[model samples]
Target: MNPVKNMRREDMGLQWLAIGLFCCFVILAGGLWYVQIVSFKKYEKYREVQSYRTVRIPAPRGLIYDRDAQLLADNEPNLNIVVYLDQLREDFTRTYHDLKGDKDLPYLEGLELEKDARYLTVSNMVYEASVIIGKPSALVRSEFESHYYRHRYMAMPVLTGLSREQMARFMEQGSRLKGFDLEVRSKRRYPNGSLAAHLLGYMRPRQRTSNEEAATLQMSFDYELPDFMGKYGLEGQYEDELSGEPGAKSILVNNMIYRQEEEEWLPLLPGKHLYLTLDTDIQKAAEDALRYLNPNQQRRGAIVVMDCNNGDVLALASAPTFDPNIFTGFLPASVFKPMIDPKGSLPLFNRATYGRYHPGSIFKIMIGLAGLESRIIDPEVEFFGQGYFPMRGRRIDDTAGAGYFNFERAFYKSSNAYFIHYGLKLGPETIVDYGNQIFLGKETGLLPAQETGGYFPSKQTVRKGWHPGDTANLSIGQGKIDVTPLQMAVMTSAVANGGTVFWPRIVAGWESMMPNGASVFEPEPEGRIRGRLRASPQSIEILQKAMLADVENRNGSGSICRIPGYLIGGKTGTAETSFKNSNGRRIKHTWF
Candidate 1:
């Protein structure tokens, strides 16, 4: 009983000590809560510093169309691959540590080495991508370096324009392998190849302009990627209206890559369609005729067929054209650029409204009109024709050889002497007045960029050192008087339509998008008023008869222009371009 009591006293003391230990554990837990609850944000920030991601969102481009609602330029599905730089940092550090290979390396001791290690991280990623995609690749070192140095948040593009097979392989193998992604992008397509190349135009590599783009990040486009903009023609002029606004997306990104978590922004807008006055069938026809005449080589020629009723240019053809599609990609030396050089021929030159040539015998029509109005010459007045007329000591030759001629005979024959005699009688001042009275020597203002202001020698221009020779030259459609085929067509149209001159138009109407699909807007006619010719019906009748005879009469110079069942009025010309060439030799350039 005494031994038991002594043991119990010590055991009782040990039991009390165990109870105090339990209470101390509770106190330690409460202290832990006090510190952790207050400092949780700091620890969360530390974790975020270890792993966070950023991604980029690409905006969708606008659609392009032809006048008839044909899709000329549209986006095709393109698969793009990009890599996130931030996610690889941890792996890079681990790789760096392994590469050091048991060397005694203090943390943060090698600053330049760390930079190299960072580069190696990206390089390894590229190597892995190359191996997975079966493509030879490495970091475009300078580009990578620059991008990382400038914008660390931006996702780097490893590859673009991936094929369907490649994209499938990427998704199946590359995406699962990590740090690589698949994205659908839009690529521009031209469905008709080279049709309407000059008119539809082509695009160049351009960044998204701030005014055209919706978001701010979109404007920070750091690369000069291939994109197209209309360079010339109607395409260049109406680019803005045709190129609709670009839409944006706010991409939700985790620190890993361009994950495309959510497209939290605006939708894309499609472009409007354009309608032109050009009839594809007629344009093709006109082009065929020019080619048929000179099939061996490209001849410097133009054709303009207009609807005399309204100023609609049914067809305007020019030789030496290019397919607009080629301009969108890499332009070869064989195309539109060569002609622009000073030494090059510029065969693709639009000559319908642009080429200014001496009117030649065609001007005799205007001269005949003026003479009939002046009453200096009558249709019945027979003048004894000589092969050449002596004028101011210079002899002017007639296209027709010597014969007795009335106005109608002279007109049908295109006698230079007869017209010269009448043209001089009208005086250079009246002729100049008539030239100016019509829109000659000025722009027709149809397409200013594609047109020229034809020249007419004014009295002021003539009197400055005026010579009777100059007047004589003017009499036969030579000297400082030049006109475009378009101008001639206008004159002919005026004669056909009772003397109302017109401004030529190419666009008939435009198509717009309705809620369902597409809708077309109508076209309005364009033209101007030139002075009305107060012609005697007899005079007009005589001139019309001569013009018809010029085409219908087998002996007439313009016999080739005669079309069966169609009473055609016509004139033909062959003119010389120069008096001399190199090597001190006399030469001449001719057009038939």
Candidate 2:
């Protein structure tokens, strides 16, 4: 009688079970959709945090060329042998197993065994690399452990700056040296060694930037590759342009901090090429001449040559120049000791721009111009000389013969007595007027922060001091004025270019190099004039004639530089310095 009722109850129970199963399927599908489509980015970022390491990579440095397109400063490939820790993961585990042989250890001992295993594995590979390169093991246990803990994703260098023989040896058996590989990087090179060293400057190895604020506030890094920074001259002046922009890369790693793969995060832009206005041939000649003139090789002096028409510096040379290559890395004490000579011949000092000395008779040209502009000096008029001029109860001596000297004869013979007489008549105000026109007391702007604004007495100072002896010293270009060879070159250029003083030019331009070996140039306008002289053309012409006579006449002090048929012009002087040298000797600055 209850059979029909039981069958109905069973059917109801089956219906309830099917409905419950359907509800469970719906909840699972909704949860899958929310996780797969909505929260994907959040989990992806979490994965990256645990597995990826970011590294800062330095860009290649710019190439430096001379006026002739010859490389003055360059970059050459340096090959190194290193062991990639990532590739040694298997060896580390196998070595740990081997070291733990036949015993189970405590947790602390086991951790140290893992450490020993890692160092032993890396050290063994380093020994293999040392054998191949014929060098000692560069690996240290403590350093290896520290690196393994912190930067296990990076490669460790085993043999660096490989010599040609070492490189050859490695190449012969590199394939069998598992986990060790060769990496080529660029390094600064000066092919001519000390040639144009001061002008070209040197670089220092830097791992990070000098923007301390940015480094502290914005820039963060776990690791970085070494880069170079310019320290002086043209290299230093254009640091931003030469170093270019830095980039970054991402290292995909496992839980063991071993790199599995790598991907470039930001592409690096290469630096521009710099072209200088200097002529290498002229620079070499000037340097050779300076070396030749100083037979003892201890002279501390400088030379500057310029293009009178446009103010382009053709050559600039400084004695006791250093080989800039030594500065790229750790400077050895032996090489550095010789550079700091006891005689005050510092190789790092750039004398062409930084040296200051009494201009002596080279200042006579400005004095003559002042006299001519004042209408007190007539080129053809003759004056009597007693071999010295009397002033301030003192006599300024002259090398010229005591005789009647017309302006031409006086100038050609460097008649200090004649010029001093006229210079006194023109007075300090008129003389300073001419000096200002020639920019005698100002920096030439050839090298910023490195050039000196040489000393020239101002009218205010002269008026305050007002000593007749000072005026007498000022007359013959002796007491109060100082200058650099670069300044003299500029002053001489003003005379040669008919009184248009110019700002000396050094760097010519910069260019971007293309991958296909072609260059895209960015030209800088040349021959920028600093100022124009107030003297007339006739005055300049007269002064030029006098300078020519100085070189042409045998009685002239500058006659030593005279070459027949070329009509070369010059002035010579030996000036007394107020300071004593390091060896307690009085110094004199001699000039041409």
Candidate 3:
């Protein structure tokens, strides 16, 4: 009897368990159905009502200044006329309804008509604002449509870089206009105009943010504030460092796409200041000597001056230059066209770092270094020059001809046969060894993306097509080689600074621009040795004495550079590019 009672109790327990499972399944299904079908539209409406539109606002680019706190490239306040599209939604709706009254149109056609209405409203608003400022403005239909369809949630740029008079008039009378407001954005300005244009570089308008930043925000931007991207020189090279992190703002909109509120989602981090090693006085003076003092004021040439102690670029001047300030605004065809013309002298081209031409006799510095370091050169020993270096039955003409020359006489005179004679004794391997040692076939690590290493014979190339003629040309800085002015400066510097070859440094340091008129500088290391020439102090003194004579002596090749105040030490170079001026005049590349 007890066994039968236990069985009945077990059966009741199983039945209760089955009933509980059935109830749980029913509740789960009911909840699923309620959420998927019943409350779907309600929650969807709420999601749409709380929509967020992200717009990226780029931080101001870092200010660029010389080592002495003289501003080379900086930002000035630019008054831009902009209109908040969200604030104009009411105007758009009213205009659309008025335009579509009593008209039955297809869905697509109606969308097109609504677009037209929006454009008309914006155009009218811009026109009214322009009337107050007494300035005429044009609102192209296509441009207006593109902005509306692509970025309706963002502020539309109407007019940029306005004059003070126009800005004052707008504030006085046109502030009452709906949706139109003046925004003050940082506009790049060079106080000295074209001064240091090549080094400081230029900026072009490009509204964008990096993919990494966009991913970090976990949002797609609907619009971005207009920002400038550096095109060349210091501005372009350190773009990432100079371009501070962009800020973000979210536009909260209602279900009807009306902007309800706005909030700054991220604080704007201002860009750092790039302190350069340029001396304004020397830079200006160099420019004046190159351009204003020259017989032909519009000469296409480049000049480079470096501090031998640290490879600091003191002055880098390129003639036939344009103003950097011209790039940030409406660049007329008249100004920008000539700079980019293939047949014309391209002022935008940085001749100092990028242009490649035969190094000429300036390369003799390396030849001399090679000879002295290899113990084959005696500064006191003399050699006879036959006016030219003969190789492969071919004669390479020399400026210093038919003279008995020693290391000092030949160097100051730039005697090709004498240097070539010694350079041959050292062999191509020894010379190439020394050339590559000074990073001759490589960039000086000066500008970011702006330097060519110039052409030097690599170990592989020198090993293979090994010709005595090539070595002869290498001695005189003429054949199968080219260099820029910056490279020459580094070469000259090495000789002056006792063969401690350095990586040229243009940007000295960088520090973030603080808000409270303070800065924290992170100084970059000075005199970073890229390679060593392995030359002794006596060899260096010999070269210095020769270079000094080249300037100080009357018959020396570089005698023109000799002035009373400065004891200049230099080598003379004449590169035969066979390049003629646009006017068909013979303009020489007399490298000094």
Candidate 4:
């Protein structure tokens, strides 16, 4: 009697179970729809943020050229073997599984095992690359591990500065390797080797400044290419103009962190080219002249050639130069040590502008002008010398010997007695005033951070310690007087060009390189006058005539420097200097 009722109840229970299952299916469907459609963009954006990466691309540095459009400094393409970490992820996973199965290997776990796995995979790739390039290459374990941990998004460099043959080999075989690629980078090169090293200066790897680091922290970039910075000379002076603006690139990556495609977000703006006014031919000539003066190269001196009409430095040469290319990368102690050696010739020093020397009889030119201005001596006046002059209870020797000397004869003979006599009469103030007019006590403003304004006694210094002996010493270009070869060049140019002092021009102008390979920029004007000497035309003309006779006359002290039919006028003199030796004994230094 209850069988039919029981069967109906069982059917109802089954119906209830089916209805509950249907309800659960509906709830799951709604949840799937909410996740797949309602918030699809949000999760997609999150995935993109995790997978994609931004990279910073460094712009190429500007080119440097000489006055005649000769390439001095330029960038050369350097080939490098790079390992794309994104493409190595799958290999890293597969290698990790294989490594885990090795029973003979030491127990490794967590990050340590993962690091070994990544390094092993990368090392194998490097070995394969080396074989293809026909060169031996290796990856440091610690370096690879550190890079994997900190800079996995960035490509790891396996081989740098590849030779042309090696680069060609890699280009052929590297495409077969999944994560391997060849990258070309611009490297700074000096085409002239050591020529004009001191004037051109050098470069070093750029480091992120505090401000740059802070700015980078605010932006998003997964990798950054290395940059360079100018260290000295014109390089340092025009750093901003030479270092171009950096650009950015967006790297599209897959879910496994493999790079898919890359697009440059911003194009790099290249730096402007720097054109210097240095004449290579004249520079070589000036250097050659100095070398000829000291055949053994033991003598230290500087020679400067300038355009008399404009004060443009044609050449500024100093002995004992160095190659600037060594500073482009890591500077070894072997290369850098010699430059800093106290006992060495100091090849890094720009002696033409930085070296201060006693002008010797050369100062007589200024003394002659001073005497003329003070009316103490006329160009035609004659005086007698007794081979020496007695002063301060001591007799000052003269190289010109005892004779009756006019201004022309005394200057041509470099008569120290003749000039010293007039110097005492003209006094220190008037002489210093004339020296100031020649810009003797001030910088020439030619090369910044590469010039020294040679020491000249100020009126205050003279007034504080006024003495007849001091006046005599100052008159002969000794005592407190000092001059650079560059200053002497300027002085000589002023004498040649009727008293107009021009600010020495070095860098002619800048030219900007455009994408179409065309250059654009304004040229800096030539012959910018700095100041004019206060000497009257008549005084300048008299000084010029004396200078001409000093070289043109057969018995002139500077006759040795005379050129045929050039009418070149010059003065020569010797200065006495003393320095303490290593044993603490004073030693005399004779300078010409």
Candidate 5:
């Protein structure tokens, strides 16, 4: 064997080994690059999914004010004692280990153990917190368990609506309690109590929104802080504007599912303030007038005052009122029972907008206009009355005695016979046409879902199935004709402000919250005009004189409603309704 050949063979074998080692090194480097750069974002996202949670925070609601800038509905600070679950992780683990001891317990399994540990830890903390705060506090086991299962990411509320004394105690001693703190939240409050309760409406607990942004975040939300909703009146009408845009926060958690820190990614946008046309003083006066009118308050009625020039509602008062603040907290059965009573007075009912009543002689205003427009009767023309008007051989009795009376005399006396005579002479279609012109038998479109379009006979019904008896009943705001006090106010306002009928205005505009809170939005000028009366100027003048006579004349029936310094003019009315009594006997429902 040659030595040189053997050395060459060994060198070649070493070369082959080096080549194999180089290939292996190249493969390792390529794999490292792919993992460190190409797939970095995927793994990072996986880590984030395990440790990050998104929470929704409700934005503060806007304030509500009257025309004079008086606060009607507002948000007051509410102190609550809350438990942060993430901070309690160590305590929960410690409790679980203590309960387990040195042996494996059968009950200490996944869900059961977690629930038991959480409840025990939170309950003990709540007890300790109670002593520190000097208030008796309790956390139900079921409540704690349910909260842990459903809303583990959010802070659990243990004690809510703390008073000043309790809050002071908590602030003084809260530092000693782990995972416990006082959170200041806003709560709806009506400072004036029951005043304008129906107009201001009430608020309910926060609920999840159904807006577009909320829909996108529905699946991503780990915990959602609720926002309040308006249940009625102006609050309900403008819910979206009053409840501002919600903000979002992200919580960075540890491997143990405990929160390390939280950052607000989206800041809340505060809601715009609302300004209403209601005058506080006038509203109080109207409510007081209604209350004192009848000592027993058995007389259920409503009063509505309006700005004849602009159609802005000044005051709307309804009897059997309730304090809207009752809805803010847990309502007692004593307070709640009467409001829901079906057989008794419904205090929740807004009589000014919802109640339907026979306008009685007030309908005579429309009848007088119809007669003057259609040339059926003159204001000075005298009609002979025999204490009652004859209709289809039946007599409709009048409060005014039999006499040869003109329009002014009959109007001041509220003569049913005189009005009924003109009502029949004008025919049902002519009268129904005039009623429809003023938006009778139609919704006023003021307060949504809070108003009703009272019953008014259609022209078709009067023309197709016409009857003298029906005509007679319809003549004096009876039979099928019914109206709300708000509607009557509009009618009165139309008479006062020439022939233009304006849509009733409740909310004046949207205002800012800053000092001097100027209006951001106002109702359009044309939005206030509902319709205009087709009556001639002379006709309106005649009706105005007759109405004034009803208040100023010596024989006036509406003299009781007269204010000494004010030369106010109004007409009085009485309506009769039949109903069966508890003894099954017929009884009359009289309204004056």
Candidate 6:
């Protein structure tokens, strides 16, 4: 045989083997490269789905301050012991034995009793927590399960509203605890609980925001953080300024359950401080006056005080008001029944700016101006009113005994018959002309959706088959006329300020944090000149003198509203409401 040819064959076989090995290596290397680099993002995304969770740490809510820099609504620190469900994975698996069994375990387990075997595993952890934190572990098991299923990323609040001592104890022992963390969150608190409930309003739970980013962010549903939304009053009217933009926080929670660190994506902006036109001292005085006026507190009424010169609402008070703090969610329903339900009463109702009533004699002021300007009635001329006027075969009586009356005497006595006769002479056209010019029958157009527009019959409205009877009814503020206390205040203000009607200002301004970490704020007010009285200044002087006589004269009806040092000119109103009596018979609801 040829030894040289055999050696050549062996060498050729070795070469072929080496080539096959090289090809295998190349295939393996390509697969490793795809898994490690080319498709790395896809695999990493899958791992994140199972292992990583992004948590939303709520930004501290903005604070509310008054004009004097006094805190109206502020935030308080709330200590809560929270558990990350992602950390309880192994324990939950061990306890259930079968993840599928978790669905049925809740039904079989007795939620009230701590002795049930089904709850033993979860209870063991809870009981240990109770011993360490000094709280009862006999909580409803359903709460823990619901939190686990619904909100896995949000920290599970186990112990709520803990004291400072308890928080300190947990923080000290947190190193040994596997899944427990002490969370510091802000809660809304009003230092003066009921002081300005109506003006300041109360905080409510976070509303469902439509923003896609808001849904991506997370917060505990079980426990309330101070994400208060204004429900009524100025808080609601100026909600955007009071509820400044919420800041963003990223909580880095590791696999072990403890929060590793936290960073602010956007630093929390403090809510803009509001400086109101309301004078706190004057507000207190008005409130005291209202309570004093109705010592029994049985009368449902309201009082409003304003700056006639500047259009600033100094104070506004309503009867049967509730503490706005109660609306914040600490009290049970039972405690709030009488106030919330009120049976036939409405404690939460803001009667001052919201309640609509007949202006009574207050309407006479506008009527007098209308008649005097239209030349239908002369202020100097005398009318013989025999305490009543016969209209459409029905006689209407005057509260003030009528006689030969000049304009000044008629206004002082509030002679309904005289005003009614003259009002009819001017007709609904002139009356409504003046009324609409004064912006009556419409809102003052200040804060949107707050005050009523107050109604008055228009000429166009009356021309559409309207009756003379309707004009007779409206001559003395009856039939279709309805006015809010704010409307009355504004009406009176126009008269006091010589015919320039201004919007009533409530909320002052907003306080907010700037990009440079400095606080920025501005004033907000609604001001406008609605109209000028078309009457001669002599007519105004005649009415003004009569109004003064109504307050200062011995026979004046407005003596009750007078202050010793200040000249207060006001008119009284006694309205009739539709209500049922004790005998199941209908009767008039009286208002003073």
Q: Candidate 6 lDDT, tens digit per residue, 78-180? A: 7787766566556654655543443544643533222233345555665666677676656467886575444445677777788888777777765566566
lDDT (C-alpha) at residue 139 in model 5: 91
Answer with 1 or 5, whichever has the higher TM-score. 5
- True lDDT of residue 289, candidate 2: 84
Give lDDT tens digits, candidate 3, residues 169-250.
8889976888888989888889999888998888988756558766876766877877888888888888878888788899
Count of backbone collisions within predicted model 2? 0
Q: 4 or 6: which has the higher TM-score?
A: 4
Candidate 4 residue 487 C-alpha distance from true site, Å: 1.7
- Report RMSD for candidate 6: 5.6
Q: Which scores better on lDDT, 2 or 6?
A: 2
Worst 10 residues of 4 by lDDT: 102-111
Shift of residue 579 alpha carbon in model 4, Å: 2.6
Candidate 2 on 477-573: residue-level lDDT in tens? 7888888899999999999989899899988999997778898999888878789999899999999988887888787878888887797887777
Superior candidate under TM-score, 3 versus 5: 5
Candidate 2 has its poorest 10 consecutive residues by lDDT at 213-222
Give residue 185's error in model 5 in angstroms. 1.2
Regions more than 4 Å wrong, model 6: 1-12, 15-58, 86-137, 165-177, 211-226, 249-268, 295-298, 330-343, 580-592
Instruction: Provide the clashing-pair count of each candidate structure.
Output: 14, 0, 1, 0, 1, 3
Q: Which parts of model 5 have CA positions greater than 4 angstroms off? A: 2-51, 107-114, 211-220, 253-257, 294-299, 332-337, 513-527, 580-592
C-alpha local distance difference test of each model? 0.67, 0.84, 0.84, 0.83, 0.83, 0.69
**Of 1 and 6, the candidate ranking higher by lDDT:** 6
Which residue pairs does candidate 2 place in steric collision?
Answer: none
| 12-108 per-residue lDDT for model 1 (tens digits) | 9999999999889989988888769977887655544432232223333444543354465566776778876666677768767767767776667
Worst 10 residues of 5 by lDDT: 518-527
The whole-model C-alpha lDDT of candidate 4 against the native structure comes to 0.83
Q: Judged by TM-score relative to the true structure, which candidate is superior, 3 or 4?
A: 4
CA lDDT, candidate 3, residue 281 = 96
Residue-wise lDDT of candidate 4 within 258-346, one digit each (tens)? 56678897888888898888898887787777678778764567778889898877788777777888887778899789888889889
